[model samples]
Target chain A: MATVSVPRAHWSGRRSTLASIRLAVLTFLADPQWLIPSMIAPIVFGFVSFELFLGTPDLVVYVILGAGMMSMWGQTLYGSGWATGQDRNIGTLEPTLSAPTPYVFVVLGRILWNVVSGLIGIVLVFVVVVVATGTVPSIDNPVAFVVLFVFTMLTLAAVGTVFAAAYVYTRYAGFVQNVGEFAFYIGTGCMFPIVILPFWTNPIALLFPPSWALDALRYASIPGYVGFSWGLGWDIVGGVATTAIYLLIAGIVFKRVERHVLEVGNLQEY
Target chain B: MSSVPAIEARGITRVFQSRKGFFYQDVTRTEALRGVDLTIETGEIFGLLGPNGAGKTTLTKILTTLLLPTSGTARVLGLDVTKDTERLRARIGLVLGGERGLYNRISARENLRYFADLYGVPLAEREKRVNEVLEWVGLTWAADRRTEEYSRGMKQKLHIARGILHRPEVLFLDEPTIGLDPKSARETRKLIRSLLGEGVTIFLTTHYMFEAEELCHRIGVLSRGRLAAVDTVAGLRDLVGGDRTIEAEDYGFEDSELAAVRHLPGVSKVVSEEYGPVTRLTIRVRTGDLTIDTVRQNLIGHGGLQVRERRTSLEDVYLDLVEEEAR
Candidate 1:
């Protein structure tokens, strides 16, 4: 085997993490059109829903939770779901993909930072909701709520990763992202109870991890609300299990799509 | 330096399937590279020259591990491009032409730093390396300015700076100076020469024959997805076998006159193109069969023509090779 002496890289794990954080911040700062809408839309929706429900205690909790979840969903959609496409548009996808570090890690790092940024928005909206509705959200089980939140974010990140991979092969990523967002908003029982919808919709909504995550959050937050067929602990368990499964599926899908893109030489194509 | 070649590609081929319209039914397969074999020794600047669609970019993509070959094997810095892609990427760098690759929103320094991290440059050395490369590319003064504000040449320089952030042993430059002013192109060429002095092996694909002749230690002329010839500049110039190229500037020359010139004794090839007010004609003839006096006299006799003997260039060699392959 012919070999050549090249300078070895001084490998450092921390550098990639730092770089991803910087990229996330830069990307966020660069696109104010997306960021402002992502932040303001959820808060506005929460307020409108609160008023529509006549400021009821139960609906206040529901709308605020929905608002927080939507904030996260928007971030994940643009930050992770459309990430590869954005890189392709910016012409950085090829160079980033060609780097020594695995492309998946770079993507995951971006997702992590986006999630962090989304958390800030979530907290702000929560504060605004509390101030406007004059109701502090009550968490019946703190541990379960925390577990459900973590699992829900992970699940969304996983779904976003799968979407990012799918975006590479198709030109209709923007359309899909828009449709998928509204689909999740309506299907996941964000503003209203999934039970109130058609009985046939229940099964389809159940397939999405966010539905169960929202169910868990609703049960844990609303006072005297024991509406779920499953108990709070069971709902939390279901969300976690579904999220883990989605993550596994996402990992497999991402790897396969990555291989396909390289084989087809479409990494640079818009 | 080690005895091992910096790059080794054997029987490499790439076939792409183009989908007709939106439907996948009427697919057409186009072979971009057909069984290419190449070896570049360590610290050597190898230039690959070809017209468009000659598989120059395809071959570079394969060696850089950006695109996998349909068949055959390639290794860079001792690592198989397909199997050890991650490792090979660490040891090699790629500079694709065009201004689209870098993040225009970020500063040149920031872009270099980001790539350094992606290349796994150590946290301690990332800053120093970014500064070193910025200065190396002569962009240190504009390091903090957003890249979108930078000129085309500056952006190209930044691309080179990013490629070298990891200090790779083998660097692939695909048309490093495609669209640039003469002075900027010359500066880029000087930068590439300095990199060669650092013992970095460069695999450059370019359309500019003059650039290739000046920088490349060896040149490979590719045509129709195959290596037509691989030799030094002088060796390629010898392909014509002592042929002298005579260039003539004339106006109001008809098609019949061009045909008459083509029938001239010992003339192997005649290329004519419009240049502003004058129509420029390039005639290649055997050195012994045709003298400058005879060619000048013939063109003068044809009426309304001015003839001069221009120096033969690698472009003449390239055009002849490509035209031969096309035939």
Candidate 2:
């Protein structure tokens, strides 16, 4: 009997992540209706935040940073997790889960797409606020402010990466995320400073990486800021620490959640 | 090749638990596989035949590493399915050809390319391999069309293309031709046959008895989570009673008349079913000594009677094995 040649299977983290990113781009291009809700909420919140922060001393900066963070939060916090929900809805979860690649990188690729989209959302919020208020806020350090802004989004990705596992853990992840949406806004101080919300809630808000990052963004961009009083260096340290912790938790959760789904055999269900 | 079976399953079982409504608060556990043990040699097509809800898909899913079993062990190509899922998945392929498993918005070529990358096809060979599989499944013509626009048959072909894209050593196909047109289904079968040359072991689950008879080196009949029988088509035919079957249709037949036919030499088993206004008697005979003439003469006085004789089919063998297990 003649033995036939069989190609040995190769495992590449880079290849899987790139393929997942390509899939995300292709899906968004084909049917972009999903981006509607993401866009609509941000535009509404941007206008509302501009009006509500009318007469504060650093009003433009507050409105711009607050509304931008709000809009970007929708994508970076929920969009990445929702993409995992989409995978479950379309029945791609089983095939992707069964593939040789670890599912975490697949979700990582998707979160990266949402991270880019979130940054774009911030720009849209910037334009919307600029057109509404005819005044541009001055950044004390432009490069630091921009770098911190991008870093803020990365902090959200860390949180989103951990949250994306909820979709794999249960089909009701969408419902849970929806219920948590406004709470996310409150806890992360998207529209207002967390210090204004109450002393007891501050500890809870600090648990989220974005809250720390958002505080650091305020210190860098807003002049005479008095929100945390911890200064820029401490806020950055806090952001880095919280984001690293969240990512570590994400890596551990994804493995357990994938194993749990395989054990339960509900990867077929949405 | 290495003397190890391509697939070796030992007492595999899966149980599903479903919880009822809020007021009821009851949990129901249904055992999908009781204890299934099977083995298939490398480069052979092994078909599993069963009625609906007969654990066929459960067993296939367990072996493919998509679902964990409640008990027992399964090894594919010398890799344990549970412990070595990642390593085993690259060496094996699963084709669940249907609308649900595919990315409908993308072209078939894109779907295969993504999967090829996931399977670790070298970047240089990915495009060529994708194109090669598209040609194999006869989807080269519509390779660029969004799969949402393709017919179910076309999607099925694309699925087969993806399954073989990385040249997996073993492929598990769950009802590969379930909803395809005859020509497309035949093409699918032909493509499956061609894979034998590459020494790909195939595990097929299908309700089409003739397909099992035509393609499988051996067939297993699963009944309500248990294996009723496993053998070559001829061996199963002999196990059921014979190579020939005789059918007699009438309004009805008295028990004594049926008993007389049963008492005839070489008659092995007798079964009767109602068809609207009339009843049909299916007689399984072990020898050529029993003929349609003999069956007709046995029911001499029956009116509006029609008699026919032909070789027993796999359907009959399958039905016999399943029904016997039910009893």
Candidate 3:
């Protein structure tokens, strides 16, 4: 038997917790009710109404990619925050703090589960969309897509942490989820084009990485999509960079808020 | 000084000042740990003995690096608790009261393995270590059982196993054995003793004085955010002075005559109960002065006193301590 390494402060428990949580999530996704609607609705909405929304079958590719990314964002946020509220009620957070692993490792372990769950949601969206629309999302820049995907997921996860921290403090999770949903709608271009949002909203949305990602993914997945539009290239680059900065800022802020709430020590108080 | 000890706290204090609900005008202040200083050696089992609302949990939280002390300093393994908390955390294992380990839906073995992973136990050794720790706490028979289905004693045993699973140098057990039956409690105590022999330092807190007496090499009495006393069990007993209780029946004695017996020397407090024109007086006495013949002689003159029972107990000492604090 190999020796077990003692956790240092720098060590994060992401890899291990992620593996276990992923298995649990996959097991949950195997259930029909949860697996079906979240994945199928967006695809069905895309193919049946593709011409209605985008005016052509070629644009079906962008619709599928947009729906897929939105599903990832939504499902990840949902799975990630549920445990935060439950763990606080059970009084497990304080003990987890007593361990050697950095707090981020513990938190990220929770978030990673959401991401994996989000992956399931994404896969379901992909399968349904591919079957319904009969058009696969083509990736022109797979590397950039992968990089932006991770960055977008991480940034959204950070946002989830902020709300989870708030949830632990106030137990008003409804308000937090509402704000997250609103942010997702505006930042991820779920219902509207990012270019069409007011000039001021663009900068605010750009602060989140997903805005640039949806744009980058849209441009990368469908050829001629970018050529159809101009003067928005800077939005993609600036948005990505700004989103990265916002993610860093959000992570720091989340940690501060979480520590403050823990010091107050009223996790389940209404 | 005894190789610098494993745990030390000097004037540790934790204060919480929070705003009022809704109105937010007044800030309520709670002093959870107040100027508490303590030291425990590397291999000794130290107990923090206190009752509910006595700040035992708050002090434990501070020492474990879960909450920062508002004032003073704590060092775990010579590393400052607040500044080097992560380092301190790795070296220590803490089992809090209630079921903090073993996810309710997961099997016991899976729960243990997950913790092993969190502590960075390598994948190859995780299974073996999980089994070993499970067996140590006598939970191997039910390793496949989901925690939600386990009995209270079983959950407690699994918690103990998880705390030791990482093979930490020091262990902090807060109210361990809280919900266990007599048989399970005995086994838990035995396991704790064995761990001490293996050189794992333990810091424990409990409301049960007998549990502390049986397991702790040294103990501290915490009451009302203060360390009332810290010493060996014998030392604490000495502080209260060895005291005893005597219960006797007085045959053919009325209430007025019972007053005479209560006034006897060394009998500090007396309680009388009527029994068919006979009276029974339970007396608290100083240890050296308590003797059956002496009691018999005091009551024999009336020819109505019948000595019934005499016992020296720790509860008497505990009562004295609380009484002194109340005064």
Best by DockQ: 2
Error of 3 at B6 (Å): 2.3
The TM-score obtained for chain B by all candidates, in the order given, is: 0.86, 0.96, 0.84
- lDDT (10s digit) by residue, model 3, range A1-270: 112234432334565556446434543543465554355655554553355457654565655556656666665565556566556655655555566665555556666666666666566656776776677766766776677667667666766666555555566675668666857665657544567666677667655666666676656655555521443366466556765676576567667765666466554343
Predicted complexes: DockQ each: 0.49, 0.70, 0.34
- Model 2: per-residue lDDT, tens digit, B165-256? 88888899999999889998898888888888878889999999978888899999999898888889999999999989999999999999
For each candidate in turn, the TM-score is 0.91, 0.96, 0.83
lDDT of each: 0.80, 0.86, 0.68
Q: DockQ score for model 3, please?
A: 0.34
Please identify which of the two predictions, 2 or 3, would achieve the higher DockQ against the true structure. 2
Task: Candidate 3: list runs displaced more than 4 Å.
Answer: A1-59, A133-151, A154-174, A196-200, A222-232, A254-262, A266-270, B122-124, B248-284, B287-289, B296-309
Candidate 3 chain B lowest-lDDT run of ten: B308-317
lDDT of 1 at A59: 67
Cα-based lDDT at residue A45, candidate 1:
70
Model 1 TM-score on a 0 to 1 scale: 0.91
lDDT of 3 by residue, B1-327 (tens): 237678999998888787976889989898887899999888889998876887888888778777778889889878887788767777788888575544676678877766676666666777888999889888889998778888878888888888887787779999888878889888888988888756788999987878988888888888778888888876676666434677787565555555765666776666666778776776766555557677776665566556755554555555556556656
lDDT of 1 at A243: 76
lDDT of 1 by residue, A35-106 (tens): 575677777777766676674656656766767777777787666757667788878888987898767777
- Evaluate residue A121 in candidate 2 and report its C-alpha lDDT on the 0 to 100 scale: 64
Candidate 2 wrong stretches, greater than 4 Å: A1-3, A34-41
